[model samples]
Target: MNEHLTDPASEGPAGGWGSVKSIARIYGETLSNPAVLETLKQQNKPGGFMCVSCAWPKPANYHPFGFCENGAKATLWESTSARCKPDFWNDHTVLELRDWKDHDLEMAGRLTHPMRYDADTDRYVEVSWEEAFSGIGAVLKRLEPKEVVFYSSGHAGLEASYLYALLARLYGNNNLPQSSNMCHETTSVGLTKVIGSPVGTVVWDDLEKTDCLFFFGQNPGSNSPRFLHPLQEAKQRGAKIVTFNPVIEQGLVSFVNPQSPRQMLTGEETVISDLYLQVQSGGDVAAILGLCKVVVEADDDAKTLGLKRILDVEFIEQHTTGFDRFVDCVRTASWSDIERESGLTEPDIRRAGQIYVEAERVIGVYGMGLTQHSKGALNIAMLANLLMLRGNIGREGAGVCPVRGHSNVQGQRTVGIAEKTKLVPMDKLKELFDFDPPTEDGTHMVDAVKGLMSGHVKGFVSLGGNLLRAVPDQRDMEVAWAKQELTVMVSTKLNRSHLFPAKAAYILPCLSRSEVDDQATGNQYISIEDSFSHIHGSIGKRSPASEHLKSELAIIAGIAKATLPVNPKVTWDDWTGDYSLVRDLIEKTYPEDFAKYNERLNEPGGFYRGNAAHDRIWKTPEKKAVFTTPDQLNSLSFPDRPGRYRLLTMRSNDQFNTTIYGYSDRFRGIEGTRDVVLMCAEDIAEAGLAPGQTVRLVSDFEDGRRRELGGLVVTQHALPKGTICSYYPECNVLNAIDHHDELSKTPASKSIPVRIEAEP
Candidate 1:
């Protein structure tokens, strides 16, 4: 753990993307006892806190320490001895540090003081919090408010989330590029277009009633381990679970419940999945299409073959539009085309469709795997389409569920963080805050990055998040980031964002929500919305990381007070002193589920935010769930084409976003490396590539930029011919900045077109 302090030199095979390799290398050399336990014990005391990197919600009867390996590392990193003093920055230049490895940047440790970059010396010089804010405010005042884009990450709490939104509106720019833009933006784009909301309609209890669950593109073992217990319970009750993904994840295959006593003591594990389908990368579109085709055929042949109609004719006749167009869309799609694009035969699609027909109720579960693609929104819409064919929506055990990355990312958007349609009317804002709201649509991450890079964006502020690391073509991204006139990152421990400084930058340390948030009134509770749309309140059970740390809400209020002091129209002081006031304002502005939110959150586990779709009514303009028929997609025809392989970039079990937890992908038998690529034996030989050769992958995109993954270990895994799997961020350099969904702007990091061959 101590050795992780040094600069990173190596990126492992499968976990090769992040600083994990360097960190592991550090631990392998430095720490006498690399396995540092007692993090929760030290950080979970009466007041001190741990990092929120891997806080997977536990089961009702589970212990507080039920978190996985990543959680432990995050907690340890929080309470570790690593510190970034002024001397550290004084010792290194910003330009020089940018060239360092990803792991080395993180291992640099907790930022002790704020600093601003000196362009003349190309170094970061320490700046006081006051001086930093004033310097930043000067930059903001110099440009139009629209020139500033206020971004946020999930690490930020309710107070900070609200403060960021408020700051955006007050500063005259609604350009708030949030973490949601990358992670669950597809969920939002698809769901909101179908219904009125962006979150899943299913609740946790619904898992018990489901007859079958279709898990897609999500690796629970690494992404969200807490899901395993509920899956076990559902399995015990005999729910048929099917997993659809390009990679055969171990968590989906089987796992021993560490939470169970006998299993923990005896080293026994439980079986998880019933079926595994290695669908083509970015082929979620094809997979869903093929499944729907089988359902359609089954429905068509029902009368003669003793089959039941999978299409809900009655529901479609009454509650949908453009059924004829949808029917034609599916009917026109050929099986051969689906097979070529999906890398799965017609039989695989038929089998999956048959299972859906057999189950009385079906719940569709997905995550970033299905979202980070060019056709992601369409893929999500297709999942809903398949479920709707069997009348799955509004049922007790069936609906669309996206396992969100962070704890409360959904809740932030539900409140006032949104810069678009959910915005309260100008009259409402005037009535509540005595001001006019902005009419412009706020800039998302893609647009924000472009805006900043082009100099249209001058000032930038992030509540919490590593914006540069999360974006694609990472090497080129820093140049765009460095162009910001002013940048402020409100965070807990120091991260890449601090080192990726601006002309004027401030790293205002803040208290994690796990730590007690003190106010003039008393210890206050904050609320977060979960994957299942449950609105629960959380109060810090522990103390702040340090006395110098302030609540995110407090820090935001402080900035607002310092930056917007000249006007003093509304009571910013009221918000700074207490977060409850912000809650009250939320109630007034969006008074739907948040009515009496403060009082409601005080109750244990919070309450469910109403899902109107559960009642058999959608909030669409037509008031019914419509079948979306997107454009027909065919696999790479490879018409006399050569040396092409479909590459699907993914994250390891020990990482989240840009944070690498450790150096192992336990499920894949990948240890001490992340540089390996999973492929079929036929594809390797067909491309004339040997097993242990250094290789280069060229994107089929017109940009002609080549991605080289040197020294890759080739495995004759189950990955089908023309399909390959590699770790993300490392391959993100190949994904052009503009390569994304036109509607949602979600980075097509998963479904990039590339050709791989051994490097000579």
Candidate 2:
């Protein structure tokens, strides 16, 4: 327990009146009186737009208010009355604005017009859309196709993502690296190898029927609040919930659904987790291996007693491969190593194993915690092995669920925003668009940065997101960003990324998901895929923030038209006029998954994109799911040194990916600042530091670069000894650009090695 934590509310149940107050604060700050009520009523409704926040699935049964506090904040944040017109940019120079806080920059307002950075004046001057697009096209045409990278954020809708991908392929390169490369790329790579699917097999219906829910390294309360409702319901129905994380997250402890009038009025809370294990940082692989060891031992004992087999022998034999090797590896793992690495005793591991064995069905939910590590893919593969021991996957109420952060990150990938050439269907693409996409593999986020730094990539075009803040090694990224010959950002507002202008930079304003996108045909509806592999339509009811802003589809089309040669088969004009034409192209490209894409938009809850793993149909080369064994039990190995700790980067309750909403993390007892580091008291004292002491975190990476973040106040919290937690983007500098997962190349942001030094 965090005895010295200041905020008392952090110890209380999540949601309830606290959430209501937060929503009110956001709405009050951004929206007017009547519009607030209208927006609230329409949020997550059939005809209304999706909450441009977390990608948690919308419920089939609608509640009075379907959106969560963060979701409401995201909606109002986009719909804010503030606007950043030409005059505002003229007032502030790029150099002066670079020092402004990320939150302050975005709060300045939504961008109203296309603007170009004038290096001589160090200010952004308003420019016509045609001139901006033409200049960008001219520069892109000067470089080789592989020299330009097209980066997409998760916020892009499916139609826009499809067109963006098509534009990139038509331009002759597949350098379509997006935000997911930094987060869930491990899940995609690991799961594909294990179960023959990149996406999760679980659906919304599974949560309702699950016998047990295991949360690994994810805090749903802060990341995705609406997920708490399902956890509360699961608890009420006698489902056992277990959590394995370094911090004792408030959401995993208990929940009070704000939607439930009776519970809210009575102040009653549902206890969420039956067992909470505070696993050490980067210890998930060890913990999972321990559980598998216990299960295997128990099965061995049962076999000796001639009793009914505890393991799912029939399912294992029929549906899985590599089981014998996986079991052998688990059996060889020493108990002492597991306990020492996992920071959990033998009894606790057995206790959790017992719950898994007893539960008829179980769903393993995780987020960036398990993915942003050197062995991130192995971490996921180990979790899959744990579920496979009892055949928990490919069954009702059971599967591996990787909770995605952005609204449509998975959907963007599904539509074709990948750097890997093999991930996209080249034959269908060539047939439909009559162009041969580059066979050479393009760059992921890390490699893209390297390309920029080395001057190999000359141009960059972003669909959305603050790429500068989202990536690791901030200083290096900024320096690399400036090396680009041309940089184009298609965004809703000003961000830190825009401040780091290249030789030729353009910030083109685009319609947000919450704003009405009126095309030549009529008001357009875009489709977004949730984390559960469910695709649905989102139609914005609010008016556009600025008259000069264009739809993402239109901006993508504009770039396509200006850059690529006219293809008789490709119709950018028609697609821009009606987004359904873009959907038609998408359906033709992925006929199996997106058949009848436009018609399904009218369905009440949309439709499931469908995963072969759910039907026990493995798409692996061997046509069977495979159990994998890690070369080592622990994901990271650190020497025993004083003043050294593993730093876990996290988001505050008031923040989303790269976008800071406020300084306070309401759920975590943080207030008035985002520069505090949450450390265990034992670790603090051992490092000759006290609570509230100002310290600088220094990370010395294998690349021979020393990264440091200063002015971070040390605060005591409930975390594993020798491990600390701090908000991301601030601490992202501590992670080296090249320090990432071997297989997935996702940055190892969650477990960065750092030493705390007291600031004079």
Candidate 3:
């Protein structure tokens, strides 16, 4: 829809004129449709709706305007006046709608009623909510409990996600795969292995006190705009902010706060990164090890000079294990190996290490770029090791911060939305609910896909999310999913997944985050946890998108009640009527953190879920943080072949995970299309290609299989010579479900071996 061409050189700088353009874009929609203003009024306010965007923690004193550009876009799109009513579907077929772009499908607006796909007519027909539920129940009842897969989204509130998980467990299955699989599973699995806790140790307040902030594979300006404020504050305090990423993102280079009048009027931008290092794709491990090597060498030299050693000897001796083995690894690491793998100079690595050595307090912030790889878990461990060198964890102003996506992604996991861990303890479940919850480990996202392909999994009930579109190897996944006996999607808007249904499919419409949930008792509010582990309540004041629409909580209850015979102990109806009952259940389930959940949620900004890592208390068997020594070298080796390069998939500035706000990436200076690949100028020249030439990307698999993506525009960028970059979903074809992190089982989306060929 963004028809104008963008300058191909590069994204200039974030904030300044770029932010102004974003604000103007929002007003263009708000002035034309006033409903957007209504949504903005409730966002991030006390006792109002939460922003259905990133999982960044709310400021102690919340922003008066209450949102950033991306937040505004999310609100405006959700609050649109347009609607995909029943008649609209009568004129369009699923096959036809499948051809539309993701943005166009979103522009079709909110779904107003339940609809069932008609195979004969190839269209979706309006159906009552009862009929839809009964139909789904009938199909599910005939299948084995293990045959069904319940997929949840991070966007869903705590009540709905918990109920969905409960329904799956009650139905005798543990195949509870949520969106965390594709996004933060590495953070969860990896961090737990290292420190025995998955969540970040640092709180929002830590940013203000940190003397040095290291950002690896994260772009905060676009992904988490609220973080820019603290980074700016840290800059003013003379704190050094260093960045290590494959691309030198414009957001990290500079930012202009739209809240400031002078900045808004005059384009005065604040430079963000004190040092920006463009590490190669899948090269973060090498870069970090190189920095660690410098630190070890410096400490050794200091010891020889009879000076104070840089390493935290006291902390390491008392609170950690396997340090000697890790030290041996770091000491033996060669500069040539690191330089070749990271594509960074020895001086650059030393400079970053020197900054860390001088800073008294430091924070390490990372994003998906570090997590979506075959060695993702090791990547997380490397970060932990770097911070641990100076005893940064568990101290004020210093710790590991894994930047997350979604509003309640961390919350969903907290309230029992996991596959492996049965946190609810079977004894507790029996005592409280009188139901024998299943204890067997179930499938994760990647395994779920394998189950579907093998015909072992036949039924799917999505509480939210466009799973089919969001997954890797879209074409094969789509074909495999079509063989299912039944598929049900509970969504507020129609996404690509709804179009490709199983043998029997249904789309159940639900209320948006900005709409009030008028339940049997009265209006209800649900709580969500932010990335910083703060649990807060969100109350939507706007009316429902449609009268027939139901709350996600009610829908889960309806489906559960329809599928299973009436039971007294579960109290599905009672929990749906009043969300407080759900909170009471959650409190009993996870008493360690959620005890007195309702009472604490009533507080001004909610309560913090105390992290064990924050108190320097390791939950491992050894009761100490252990240094992880990876089996493989920190750097990956590539075969000597012509035209080979590593492709890293990422999101555009105007997009969230799998949800495209628009085709243009305003911060990246990419407009009019997303069908472009960013390659280094040196590689472009080596390949004998021009700056704006067209190419077909072919992914090289270790198994000798190849995946080709055609018609991608090749644009020259300042990327590391061996690596290239492209937007996801469009480039998802290059990813295979089997290509994933061994420990976390996260699809290796960020690091794919590929080569480009001239477009024929």
Candidate 4:
């Protein structure tokens, strides 16, 4: 807090890397010895492993001063000086913590012991591990499996998530709500309809083979650092890297590679993208349609127009369906409409289209921006259709990549986390364990909140994550959470979710992947699947964040043992004491690929469990990738809500999801602030407002719900005339808790229209 020594904007533009490191640490996530040591233990090396905090997913061999500020934050968070304990929540009530800021809630520190909610005191009290597990099982056993929802987070290790999926099936609950529902649900729905699998089609190695990359709404420098090498290589090779986003992200344009010793020493940086398309929010679908139109038209004059032609007559004729209809769709779409909807003129759209046509192989990578809209699923489908037009689905360096947020978020969903997708293992479990899996699809994140509020959801056992901060409408979600009859949070830290206690609630503190895993027997190694579907072993090197902490695997096992007293075949309690037993069960219950789970995990960096993308053979009903046309192919229509501007939710460059790493957003030129709303100059004039003026966002949540948030005004970039941008979490109050995609059940986080008033 020494202002004299601080330079707010020390490493100015073109100096992104220099300022990035210290910037993130100042916000709630500071790096420490604990983080450094745990990273080292991942490699079982002397120096240290690269931090996965921000985007530090660099190659394993990337040893030369690799990692960014956010990555450092992650490492520090993993190996924090703070400790979780039973008493952590003793002084705070569910109501009290509900009033705390998101960062302040997490800043309380990691969870250290098992806890239970005391209805009389309205506080979380320390409890014996044995008591917690027994209570969890007894409550779960009493409820209809249909009424109990098991929510999993990406933070859960392979063993913990595996056990959760197994237990859910054993108890017969299809309500396996997950962190994925909030993040990549669109990718799952969209990719499955087109390619038969809800995973990225490209491998980590395939980044080298790509001739071009369409980076859609991904902030790699802030979110995922590991891909820097591949992106840098693509840039060096002249591969056309085009970025489409509402804000012109500086990280996507250029970033310094901390791994490059020469670059760091000389203060040099690498340019990332060749083209920057500031597509208005929710305009991705339109922008993509524009490209499709150009490709279909350019086919006629490929040579003269110098277009990257993609007729692919032979492939389209044999491999895909609805090509004729799709082509017609492109032709009927006029340039004026495309320009109006996309906010990019004919030349920019053409230029983007030219890059697509010129490259034989194209990879489309996206983040939450493409997944959090009303038509998010369709947006994904549009990308798939566009890729299919050019035969890009199965080709090398030509596929879709959804850069996942949390470490094992995708892996958890892939292995077992599913409330809806009929898992084959559930039937297999009934046959093996003699319990019928629940038939009804259970609650999603938003649905769970509603169910809790309605008193239909009696109990919740979350394996990981802070559900309170992560969900939409904190005010409503907290109210709903308080209504639950029983809530059990199996966690690594103390957070707001614990505050939403029921008559019986528990916060079971557990080990972090960045630290060594241990049960009664010995140390254990956990597994995580990366964005590229690479399953790597992550072992913690640091001492426990808290000595009283238990691994998530152990706690779940305790619950299983406590709940299923009549289980004849399994010794759930015995396995609860040791994680390796959990891993063994995982290898047995799922695919055979995880058979050599332990030994293979220690083999340097780790290996893949096999992505269907590798062989170009999909797992569709036809044994070939299939394309699906949505029952409706219409774009979003802003209904006549008088005086309302198109309000889009945005993550400040300094923040990630609900995790506020800092208040400063270096990218958009905002610093020491998180409350500012980004607006166009015309809107500032139209509203008769000045740059630094304060305003209130008046929202119309279709169900007659309304909210007002105040913030400073920022008039900078050229946003589409009707569109306005504001930070998420702050603006989450505007979103309707009941509104979401009927299928994916993802909250409409990106496109909610609102009206701005002068702090009324």
Whose TM-score is greatest here?
A: 2
Model 2 TM-score, 2 decimals: 0.98
Candidate 3 overall lDDT versus native: 0.84
Candidate 3 clashing pairs, residues 3+ apart or interchain: none
Q: Write the per-residue lDDT of candidate 2 for residues 1-760, one digit (tens) a residue.
A: 1212223438477898888888777777765445756877788778888888999998789787888888888887888888899999668899999899988998888999999999999999999999988988888898888889999989989999988988998898889998989999988988998899998889988998998988898989889998998888898899998889898788888778888889899998888888888899988998999989888998999999998777999889999999999898999999899988888888888888888888899999999889998899989999999998888999989999999999999999998889898889999988887777789888899999888878898899999989999888889889889878999999988999998899999999999887788888999999999998888898887788888999999999898889889899988888888998888888888889988988887566668889999999999988999999788767764454666688999888888888888876877888889988899878887788899999999995656788999999998888888779998988888898888988888998888989888999
- Top candidate when judged by lDDT against the true structure: 2
TM-score against truth, every candidate: 0.89, 0.98, 0.97, 0.91
Give per-residue lDDT, candidate 4, residue 379: 78
**What local lDDT does model 1 show for residue 665?**
61
lDDT of 1 by residue, 692-737 (tens): 6677676676566654555567765666566688887677767777
Error of 2 at 396 (Å): 0.9
Candidate 2 worst ten-residue window by lDDT? 1-10
What are the RMSD figures for all models against the true structure? 5.8, 1.9, 3.1, 4.5
Backbone-clash count (model 2): 0
How big is the positional error of residue 416 in model 4, measured in Å on the Cα after superposition? Answer: 1.3
Q: How far off is residue 525 in model 4, in Å? A: 1.1
Candidate 1, residue 169: how far the Cα is off, in Å = 0.4
Regions of model 1 farther than 4 Å from truth: 1-66, 120-122, 305-310, 421-426, 541-543, 565-569, 634-641, 704-716, 757-760
The candidates, ranked best first by lDDT, are 2, 3, 4, 1
TM value for model 4 = 0.91
